[model samples]
Target: MQQIILQPQTPDELRLVKQFAKVMKIKATTIKETPKARKKREILDGIERGLAEIKLHQEGKITLKTAQQVLDEL
Candidate 1:
């Protein structure tokens, strides 16, 4: 293994070195996907709403003709 030392001459250079070190440390760490419970709940709610819409269309609560007309207006 090889070791390198960085010596910043100016205040701006020191700040830049510190920022670079922080970015390097973050990049070296393993990233994990950990969704919060609230986020999970929101995703599930969105899915349920989509299913309800489908059910309403199937039951003729929302006519396909009206849906097509609305979509065409967009």
Candidate 2:
């Protein structure tokens, strides 16, 4: 499986592609980026979230039968 990105030249073209995707039943979605001004803060926030999850698992707040279950999901 592969992903593609499109930076439409104009709003009209963007709308056309969006509408076409919807009509064709394709699972298309928008990705809003972290503004440059807060990019560092956003990266740190994501790191904290991951660390928190790891801590929970380490503290026995969660259990895993196998990591394969998570890898297979991807």
Candidate 3:
């Protein structure tokens, strides 16, 4: 048996997929993210945002917060 992964972006899409799976007699399951998985995803997202901001700063399109300013915000 082969496994398929589907990531529906909206509720409507998810419902449609579920309906299709049901009609096809396929077992569909929802995987919930654990706290650790959620944290890791958040960290990775932050890193991506930071890298984008750094790129914008290098391009002189936006100014980034100084290390002291970031510390103060924290």
Candidate 1 local lDDT, 1-62, one digit each (tens) = 65555656687986787788797883322223367855896899999998898899999898
Residues 1-74, candidate 3, lDDT per residue (tens digit)? 99998878799998999999999999999887799998998999999998999999999999887889999988
What lDDT does candidate 2 reach at residue 31? 66
Give lDDT per model, in order: 0.71, 0.82, 0.92
TM-score of each: 0.38, 0.41, 0.59
- Top of the candidates by lDDT: 3
**Regions of candidate 2 where Cα sits further than 4 Å from its true position:** 1-34, 64-67
- Name the lDDT of candidate 3: 0.92
For lDDT, candidate 1 versus 2, the one ahead is: 2
Winner by TM-score between candidate 3 and candidate 1: 3
lDDT of candidate model 1 versus the reference: 0.71
Clashing pairs for model 1 are none
